[model samples]
Target: MELNDKIEKALHAEQKDHEISAGWRLILASALGIGFGSVGFATYAIGAFIDPLGKEFGWSRAEVQGAIAFGVGLGGFAAPIIGMLIDRYGGRSIAIYGLLGVTVGYLMASTAGGNLCYFYLAYAAVAVLGAGSGPVSWTRAVAARFDRRRGLALALTLSGTGMAAIVVPPYAVLLVENFGWRVGYVGLACLPLFALPFVLLFFFPAKSGPAAAAAAPVSTDAASAPPTGLTLKQATSSYRFWLLLFSILAMYLGITGIVPNLIPALTDKGFTPSAAAAVQSVYGFSLIVARLGIGWLLDRFWGPAVAALVLTSPVMACLILIGEPNYATAIIASALIGAAAGAELDLLAFFTARYFGIRNYGRIYGFLYTGVAFGAGLGPVAFAYLSDLTGSYNASFQGALVLFALGGTSILFLGRYPNLSAETRPANH
Candidate 1:
């Protein structure tokens, strides 16, 4: 009887550890939700609209890109609040409602005529409504379900952005080319609806309740027990949190700046819109590869070291883009930039889990993501403004080079991940 009990206990433990096998449905749903979510869809699709909106409204590139900066940066301010909500209420209702709001926001954008305020307002609506649909909610859900495979799971989930990158650029370009740009916005708006059924079906296991059970459903033990880790106050006091925050901010500034402008820059250099979008597609492919590859590397290696190596690729990409490069050169530069962009989000999520644990993961990650949103929001406008002032993108690319170097180097000082099992004790530097 004792031997039989031991065998039963061992079997239960083995079943509980089956991360991917037990939770593949949830993972698939997360990837789909994130791919169509605000971060993936809005980020990739906005670039296609920049030139079209500018031409239609007689606006400058900076003026056109300003809407994104305004909406995303301001919307990002709500992340900590949204994070708190996810912590209390769960991500399912938040993500679903957020996606619906985004659809309405995009419809508002499609109705824009010559009023820049209306355009900005439309985007602001998207950002505000869509905040819950971003990584903070989605990653929190995925983190609760995996431990040994956490890095890979996050990589898979974040690959949605990569998938968005692949699909959105060419698709948006096609819509603008055939249909009017107004119609283009409508087409983009419809994408979030497609993910709704998936989210409803697979986002959480049926047995999970709100809060703790909803956030964590890997097993009965995990579902019933409260999560362990530092609170928001505890996490913010650490230099590591601040370091990760600013490092991500700097990286996004350079990356986000380049991506929106890439289409215009290529077209300026004599590539057709179709050709420019193809290069962007290459960048998207690199994103998928990097997300998976970097996630794998983070699992096996020190994350900061992996981050340093990945982030520095943009410097070389910047150097290439500063000059008049050929088709092949443009592809190479795009791929390098894509690699860094791909790695950054998952790295942020992975670091948050490893350093802080999952107890207050939503709020901590949300606050940190605010910096990312600002950098992303600001990068495009800054790049466009620099181009308008200097008559070239060279100045902007040069500035990105500096920011990338600074961002990559800052994380090297983050040292090592603390053992969060001991997080109840004071955090030592």
Candidate 2:
């Protein structure tokens, strides 16, 4: 038999034993690592700090939100570089050590005295440290394995992020309430430490032979041999890429801006601090559900259609929050926001594969993710500035409603994916 055929036969025989593949373990580890990285450390931690920071430093809401805007936004611009490194060197060292860098940065934040610059500088370092530790590394590893259930695998991996969201916010609140934000920083550092052991899984390759060649399902016309998809240049020039890109940006502006400010916004509306934190936990619960649910749906349904539905969800959330919300309305809105935010990164990863193909998956997704990150930065600041100007967050929610509608509408134009291969087909044509 041929060498390729021989490898395939061995893989088939190994499968007959009905054992789970090495890939699934990597998926588990990926979830843990990605969960606590930027998702928990930065995204969830910042919300808890806003009130404390405002009281301690007397910083305006705009100034506080600007910290996240600059940190996560600039770090997002580094995604393509991080993605390139992962493609070349693999993700294990970067995943573990990158988080170690984040730990150090978080430690640095606890040291800031009177100077606001120190706080901003510390967050900038955390953002840079956090770049590799996010979905670019974890999701890429999961995407490389499990073509049959790729959606489910990706969802499970990203769900670690949701798990962190569910746990981190309230924990941060408790720590801040008792020990202050400095001890809260220590608490945030501990989250990534929980995932440190899982870093070893990224050290091993998921699959090792001919059957492992394609990272995902091969497109029909390109299925005979190994399939490499469109180059970065071709992908950037396509309508599908732009459509998906702007859609993610808008959806995140609604999610990222609103999520971190949820507690403050709710408390302003007459809810107590503890009650708002409880409501925020509802958002976390919804995120866990959406991450898994959206992943399953992506595996079975049309990508753009799912994107439209999820993107529109935040509009409903914003409307509910703006329109004389009750206890139940608060719960429902928080859940919608969670579902929207949780689905954004996973959908970006899946859509990158489905529309652009998987050859330059990391690079294309990185560029797109930059937009998501930038929007995350924009969302908080936008909400804060509007709140500062109008004396309430109601204006911010109305703005989010408009942006969400535009974003949801754009994806409908993506039409069909060509699944173009980079090596065989001429991208210029």
The top-ranked prediction according to TM-score is 1
Q: Write model 2 residue lDDT over 1-429, tens digit each, in one string.
A: 699999987875565233225466787788788878864546666778888888998988888888888888877987888887776566677778777867877888888876888888887877787777878888777776556466777788888878877788889899999999999998887777788887764435333123445443444423223435677898899888888888988888888888888888988999877788888888878987988898889877887788788768888898898987888899999998888877878888887877776656778888988888898888898899999999999999998899888987788888875645355432321
RMSD of each: 4.2, 5.2
Q: TM-score of every model?
A: 0.92, 0.89
lDDT of 1 by residue, 228-286 (tens): 57889989999999999999999999999999889998898888988998998888899
Clashing pairs in 1: none
TM-score of 1: 0.92
Q: List the residue pairs that clash in candidate 2.
A: 229-422, 257-379, 257-380
Runs of candidate 2 with Cα error greater than 4 angstroms are 1-22, 201-227, 421-429
Whole-model alpha-carbon lDDT for candidate 2: 0.78
